[model samples]
Target: MADQAEKLRDMVDKKKKADKTHKVIAVTSGKGGVGKTNIVVNMAMLLSGIGKKVVVFDADLGLANVDILLGIKTKYSLIDVIKSGKKMSEIMIKVNDNLSIIPAGNGVEDIANINEPSFNKVKDELRSVVKDIDILLVDTGAGISRKVTFFLKSSEDIIVVATPEPTSIADAYAMIKIMFLNYKKENIKIFVNMAKNENEAVSVYENINKICKNFLKKEFKSAGFALYDKKLPLCVREQKAISEIAPDGKFSVSMKKMINNIFKENVKIYDNPVKRFFSSIFGG
Candidate 1:
């Protein structure tokens, strides 16, 4: 009986160690103005608030905004990592002891600045940084640029933030369809933003779900959604996180529960944020 007890203890220890594997969750949107960046920031804060180490990479490239939203000013961007041959770790700025951010570097001009070789270097470096962190949230640029699409396809959990507007839903569907046609990974988890309430959010999701099921024959696994709330805008205005500024806010509380739910299901939020770019782009 003593030997059996020791064996059980050993198994428990191993499981605990294995739980440290890091993940990179990319907050994506089909259209701009859907509050993807805010979602990314708040989620990162939630992870950090609970003692998880997180790295938020503002990969908006040319139009990066995570810095402005968080009121963080970075002296370097990913450009330095490729041009100067500096490690990704060197560019990451510690927002707090447990949270860090890699801002987009400037000075690299023109489309020629970002190429296949350069991007691979960036992705590899991102992989290295995320290796030591519990969660890495990437804030990608809006729209379907080759660069943006690459990161979206690379993410393990693609949290599509869409509003109830026709354009938002249409664009969301467009992005999802692209993923299906190109990457062939049909299961996408959506996070609807700015709905009137939970019922409205669910209604929006159901519409998307019905269309995918009937037409695309695809299944969308929902991560969850946030209702339209004044607190979100207020939080942004104050340069504070929703979870922090208004911890008891309706959207904030719902998001917290959603984060916990994602964890309990073993559904990682961080890993595979578009690890494969080329195949998802022109390959299909």
Candidate 2:
């Protein structure tokens, strides 16, 4: 009996250690048209370029376009995986050996409204695939709706992208405030996009961080920034990742710097991130 108990304990320990590979990084914003999805797709491509297994989970129910941005078409998505009971492996679009994308389906169904059984089944399906990836980059919808917040609150690494526009900055603050005041999520990160220069990017982040420090007593980590690149819009129109088409472009360079900075930080990892993410969303 003691030997059997020891074996069971060992099995549990092995499972916990294996589960640590599932790292969820949710990219979100307070308003639309902030280039949040672009950042997520590019980040996934860059991470996979460096030999890291990455999964781009498009959780943006309002605008699920990660598949479109990647120029990949999918017949099934999270909706099929959850509702029709399709296998996750079937719905997942394998972009490359190191990269895969899970479309969340059309921005119609309120994923937050899913019942407990469906939620648990989805969680199980996600767990089956999540164990094989190094990072899961979730592109959440723009805004602070309940669905958006659910993903943000569940993720250990949350990157809120905001352009240098005044409205964008204000909205970014509101999003951070909601996370802090409601969920007590203090380790939020910020990425300034479309800044004119490095100084402008840092200034924008500093201003937002200062405001958060003053009001919410929380200072978000800097996920770095990108300068205004004309090539970005062109790349988007062409439906290709900037990191792929223009690997040496300003956007790609900035993204590499940001990715490196994030990796350098000693961010916390989860024992079972996939399970935790769904459980938190569904109150499991």
Candidate 3:
């Protein structure tokens, strides 16, 4: 009786402690090969570089590549959290002093198989797992999948990454459409990655913006863009993040600006949601 009571009390105390902190951000895209995982890994590193405690959760099932990009394979992944039946903390890997990662190991098919009860359990536990971190970044898979929507709706910020291809534009627009159809459009954020210039980026955002504005009767929540930098692909081939590759590079500067904007806009949303909403609506 004493042991059981003590165990119960300890569990409750730990749960309470883990429930106190965490901001969840989901990185998504309509199409693949647009540097989605690359952006995620680098962004997490940048935030950690700026003294924030961040954890990048590789939630992309089957085609997971964040681990490959980082060159740090893990012993366990979210699969273990779902199937090996370990607590969220058990499968985590500390990538840096301020940043940790939870990868997708084998048996990832199980993550998609989670039913209502299991999903509820996972959600409750993941919220607890992230409470200690300042930001919890979830790297979702490319294109539309049931698992993709699941995380997008749950995230505090959903980052839509895409490029300049005609297909990418259509898919990007389709992605925003799907989100608007499924939930409130105000919470979804879009990032145009690998563009040629500010003009090109705006053109891409404008193309998608016009559609969402006219047909959906919704507005984009927030927008930031990354221009094409040759250093990007080269660094990825070396299995290093962009900032690690060239901190002074053009792409790095733009990315940091975008991230800083994200942090600022985060605080601005509550104090000035209307202004931000309009600016995003107008591509300002």
Highest TM-score model number: 1
The list of candidate 2 runs beyond 4 A from truth reads: 1-20, 107-120, 265-284
Q: Clash pairs of candidate 2? A: none
- Tens-place lDDT digits, model 1, residues 49-85: 7788999998888777777778787887777787888
| 251 Cα displacement, candidate 1 (Å) | 2.9
- Backbone clash tally (model 2): 0
Name the weakest run of 10 consecutive residues (lDDT summed) in model 2.
264-273
Give the per-residue lDDT of model 3 (tens digit) for 127-211.
8777678898899888888777777788888888878898988888888888879676457777888888889988888787777
After superposition on all CA atoms, how large is the RMSD of candidate 3? Answer: 9.1
Model 3 stretches astray by more than 4 angstroms: 1-21, 106-114, 265-284
Best by lDDT: 2
TM-scores, each model vs. reference: 0.85, 0.83, 0.82
Which runs of model 1 end up more than 4 angstroms from their true locations?
1-14, 106-113, 265-284
Candidate 3: residue 257 Cα off by (Å):
0.9
